[model samples]
Target: MKILLVGAGLSGAVIGRDLAEAGHDITIVDSRPHIGGNCYTERDPETGVLVHVYGPHIFHTDDEEVWDYVNRYQTFRPYKNRVKTTSQGAVYSLPVNLHTINQFYGKTLRPAEAREFLEEQADSSIADPQTFEEQALRFVGPDLYAAFFKGYTEKQWGCSPTELPASILKRLPVRFNYDDNYFFHRFQGMPETGYTEMIAAILDHPAIEVRLDTRFSAEQGAGYDHVFYSGPLDGYFDYRLGRLGYRTLDFERFTDQGDYQGCAVMNYGDRDVPYTRITEHKHFAPWESHEGTVCYREYSRAAGPDDIPYYPIRLVAEKALLADYVALAEETAGVTFVGRLGTYRYLDMDVTIREALDAAAAFRASAAAGDAMPAFVKSPL
Candidate 1:
């Protein structure tokens, strides 16, 4: 079987490698000059620091299979994400932990006392919180929401918290204890070599052929037995119905001597601050020593056609547009949609890899059984 895998990101590379290993010929195409998609990383020419070009992607997953799968490609260095946020005039820990709560209030309260205090702070009026603002008010109350979340949320999403869905805030944790590790996943680490090298290894199989700077069209699916597109769903259809909403990131690059911010990521929670966060690239790979440091001030905005789409702003309007695309995808043959952009969801790295592995396995099983593969291994809608 000849397979046409588009986008050459983790999804495409993983699926292509799996299919190729199964004795199928795989041709992976990517519009970009490099692979790894958003997770692309390279050593800075000047600073010699491993830079995550798009942004800092800390690989954290509870799934042992996904953890083991990535480890096969590259050696992973144990990395824990401890984020810091500056609100008003003071700095605090992230995920609204016990220390953060104490620091914000300028009081040293015990766990039980802090929990009771937050219950008092919480807006009991919002019984059934529907929006992000309502969720924040219900969980952390007005003061913490205003100081920590409100300004930052507005800047990050470019919308009032009331306009966003409650599900967005649900992902974040509000710990009553002092666990400041950003993610609670069992396995948290980063590739010692850059992501590009890891992905290159994944696509290094004998049966797999990679074509860089190649744009794949939907009409070109005739030459292959199956097509797996990991690009934007709207892009695959050329935006016939309408463009889905997405948030694109803009990074202002600057180099400095020694440590810039003394941390990997620092979130500027005040709305007055123009940029959302400043990520020191050197801090990402602390095991490597460098005299000069590279950093990026991140700015988030609505994605234009030419801009690279990062976060899918799956609000009401975008969801409707995505629904139409999902329907169109289902109707299309010899094509399967995979990855974050294909499904139009904000997926973490682990979820993306897990889904790609499943998609590849399903394709192989279906092909062996002489059955038609579904357009989606996991439903977008």
Candidate 2:
């Protein structure tokens, strides 16, 4: 089968690689001039530092298979994300750990004492937490939530915490210990060279042909046996049911002579601050020595048609719109939607690769069994 993959990102690259290895010819196309999609990285001309073109993407996962799968293409250096936040004129460790608690209130309380103190600070009145605000108040109390989460959430989501779902806040963990590592995953690492190099290597299979700076159209898609679209779900139909809401990011880039923040990501929890976080690119690959540093100040806003969609705004209204688009996708023949944009969810790099692998396996199985392919191998909702 000659399969057409629309989007040369992780999903398309991984899927194309697996399918091509299974003796099927694959042609992967991207609208952009590059192959890595949003995970693209390039070396800075002046500093020679590898800059994350879109933003910082730290690869971390608990899945052993997913971990091993990535190691095949590029070297995986051990990397753990330790985040910091500046809130209300104070800098503190993120995920609200013991050190953060001790520094914020100016007391050296032990883990047990800090846990008990937070319980006391928590609002016992709220029986059940529904929204982000309610969840924060119930778990960490008003003062901590206001300083650490509220302002940051407001800027990131472009809405009040009350309007956001409790699930969003639930994703973040509040630690009782001094351990300040951001993720709780068993395995965490970044590609030694860069994500683009890893992805490019994946697409280097003999049966695959990569087309950069190519746009996908109905006529173009019809030429192939089947289409695996990793582009936006609404975009497949040209946003006929109205565009699903998304929060895109704008990166304000700057260079410095040496270490700027001394950390990879420094988040600003002050709502008054226009941007959410500052990412120092050199810190991502600290093993390599670099004389200069590249940084990015990230800002979030409602995505326009021309803007690159970063985070999907899957509120109630957006979910309804998504269902309509999903229905349309399901009814459409010879097409399968895959990845974050295709499914409209915030996916980590590992999850995206895992899904792509599974999707490819499903395609091969379907081909072998002479069965029809699914519109979505994984559910969007």
CA RMSD, predictions in order: 0.7, 0.8
lDDT at residue 131 of model 2 (Cα atoms): 97
Estimate the TM-score of every prediction: 0.99, 0.99
Q: Write the residue-wise lDDT of candidate 1 on 182-227 in tens digits.
A: 9999999989988999999999999999999998898889999999
Quote model 1's TM-score.
0.99
Which run of 10 residues does model 1 get worst, by summed lDDT?
A: 314-323
**C-alpha lDDT of residue 192 in model 2:** 96
Clash number by candidate, in order: 0, 0
Clashing pairs in 1: none
